[model samples]
Target: MWISRAGWSVLNMLQLIFTLAWTAGLIGVAFVVLLVTRQRRLPLRMAARCWVPGLLWGSGAKLVVRGVDRVDWTRPHVVVANHQSMMDICVLFRAIPVPLQFLLKQELSRLPLVGAYAKAMGMIFVERSSAREATKRMREAAQLVKAGATLCVFPEGTRSHDGEVLPFKSGAFQIALDSGADVVPVAIEGSGKVLSLGGLFRVRPGTITVTIGAPLRTVEIADRQLLAAQARESVVALKREAA
Candidate 1:
C-alpha cells in the first residue's frame, strides 16, 4: 500500500529523531574512546566506519559499492568525488576502507561534537577569509596525505541540488599535485533521492551506489585546471557507469 503524504511526513520525522539520537550516542562513545586512547586515526576511523553505515541502515538506505579494489591500499590518495547529498558523506565513509580525512570549510569547525571530532582527528579546515591561511592549511593537509593518510575532497565545493555533478574546483587537484599522491575520482549516485539539499528531514528509503575510479597520476601535470577537469570527467564517466 502506498503511504499518504501525511503518513510519509510522520515517518520521516520519526527517522530524523532516531538518526539524531543514534549519531549522538555513537559520537559520544567515540569521543570517550579518543580521550582514553589519546589516538585520533584509529578512533575516528572506527567511529566513522561504524556510525556512517549504521546511519544509512537506520534511514533504510542500502549501499552498492563498486571499484573499491581499484584503490591502491598501500599508499595514500587524494580522493575526489562529486557532491550530491548529505548522504554522500555516509556513503563514502562506509565504502572507503582507508582512514579518510576531509577538507571542510572553516565554518564547520564551529559545530559542536562534529567540530571537536574533526579537530581531534586532524581533518583540515579551509579558512576562506584569508588566502594565506587557506594555503597553509592546504599544505598541511597535503603533507598529511603524503604521510599515508587518505584525504577525501568534494571538489565541487558544495552539494548538487539537481543531482548533477558540478564543475570541479582546482584545490583538490592541487593537493594531489603537491603531495605527489594519485587522485582518485569517485562517483556517488542515488544519494540525492534519499536525502537531498533542503530536504534533510525528509529522507526516504533508497539505495546509494558509490563507484571508485582508478587513480589519476598527477606527478607530471603542471596545470591544476587540466588535472581538475580530467578528474571531473573520470567521475562523470563513473556516474554514467553506475547509472
Candidate 2:
C-alpha cells in the first residue's frame, strides 16, 4: 500500500497496455482456431500460451512453483487457492498449462470486454446474493468438471486485503466430491504485494510463486466438510513451504 506515485502510474500503464494487447491477440487466435478445429479445448490452450508474456510483463514478478507433477491433467481437477489480488488469476493462468475454467463471480460476467471473453472461455459465474442460484451454478460447475474441464476456484471467494488467507467456501470442495474429480491445492505467494486489495493504484513489482500440491481424490473422503478443511489446510501448508 506504500507505493510511490510514479511507480503506481507506470505499473498501471503497463498493465493496461499488456491486457489490451494480450486480449486482442488471444481473441484473434481463438477465432482462427475455432474456425479450423471447432474444438473447445483448443481456445483454452491458446489462451494459456498467450498469457505467458503478460505474466512476465509484470516487472519483477516471477513464479516459483513446487509439486507441479502432483497435478493430474489426465482428468478434470478442482484447483483451490487463497485469494489475494487480481494478479493472482493472471499468474496462475500463465503458470498452470491446463484447460481451466474459473469459477468466477456473476458480476465479472457483466464487465465490458473482459466479461465477454470470460464467458466464452466457459467460466462459471455464480450469483452470490441468491443462495438458490448460487447452488445451481455450483451444480453446473460440477457438471463442467464431469465433462473433463478443469475448474479453478478461489475458495476465499474474494481477495484478502491483509495478505492473509481468509475462510474458504465449501462449494468448490463439495463440487469436487460430487463430480469425482481430484482436488488440487495451490498456494499463490506474494501476489498481494504486486496489487494489494486496499490500494487503488499503488503497486509493487515482486516475485509471485504458485506451488501446486498433490491431488486428493474426493471419493476417498466420506464427508465433504472434512474434505474442504483438509484441502484448505493443504494450501496453507504449501504457502508456508513457499515462504
Candidate 3:
C-alpha cells in the first residue's frame, strides 16, 4: 500500500497541480463568501468539510483516524502532532473533527497569498528568531484556546525525513499549560509514503492513518519540557499502534 510506482509519479504530479489549483480557488471563494456574510470560522469549517475531503480523495489517500472517541470535541485543546510530510497538514485538517487553526512557521506567513489566507483563517505564526515575539504569539494562541479555539502545533518543529518519531519541542505544551487545556497527542502514519518523491511533494496514492490518543491532562504540568516528553511518548506509542 505504501509503494509508489515510478510510472505513476508523473500522473501524481499532474493531479497534485490540478487539485491544488481547484482547492485554492475554492478556498479563495470561501474566504470571500465568509467575509461578505460576516461569518467567523465558517470558511475553515467549509474547507474541512468539502475542500479537504475532496483534496484527499483526489490524491487517492484513504485517511483512517483511530481513537476519535478519546477527544472531547466540544471543548478546546492543544493538538500536538509529530511532523512528517506536507500531506500531514491535510491529514490533520481532515482527521481532527473541529474548526482548527495552526501554529505556523513565521516564514510561511511571509508567502504572498498563503500568509493572507492563513491570517484570514485566524492561524498564528511563530517567529522563531525572536524568542520574545514567539512567546508573545504563543500567549495569544493560549488566549485563543481559552476563547474555545482548537489549535494544532507540530512540536517536532520540522518534518522528519526518515519517518522517525522525533523528540517533540516544548512550545506546544506551553500553549496547553497557559490555556489550562489538555494536550491531545496525534500520531500520523504513512503520510510520508503518500508523498514519496521527497521534495517533489506529489501524491502517490496510499493509505494514511491518523491516531488521536487520549487527551493528556495539563493541570499540574508546569514544566514545558516534561509535558513535551510525555506528549512525545504518547505520540510515539500511537504511531507504533497505527504502524
lDDT of 2 by residue, 1-243 (tens): 587778678778777677667777777777677668867688877766666555556445666667778776787898898888888777777767777789999999998667877877788999999999999999999999998888999989888888778877877787898788888989999988876666454456688889999887887885777887888899889999899
Residue pairs of candidate 1 with colliding backbone atoms: none
lDDT per residue as tens, model 3, 1-243 = 454476567777778687868777877887787779886577888777888788787888898999989999999999999888877878888889898889999998887666788888889998899999999999999999999999999999999989998888887688899899999999999988887636566666689999999988898677889999999999999999997
User: Where does candidate 3 stray beyond 4 Å?
Assistant: 1-6
lDDT score of residue 23 within candidate 1: 79
* lDDT agreement of model 1 with the native: 0.86
RMSD per model, one decimal: 1.4, 2.4, 2.1
Q: How many residue pairs clash in each candidate?
A: 0, 0, 0
Q: RMSD (Cα, Å) of candidate 2? A: 2.4
- Please give the distance, in angstroms, between residue 90's alpha carbon in candidate 3 and its true position after superposition: 0.9
- The residue pairs in collision within model 3 are none
TM-scores for all candidates: the values are: 0.95, 0.90, 0.93
Q: Model 1: per-residue lDDT, tens digit, 29-111?
A: 87888889887767767755778877887778889999999988789999999988878877887788877788988998998
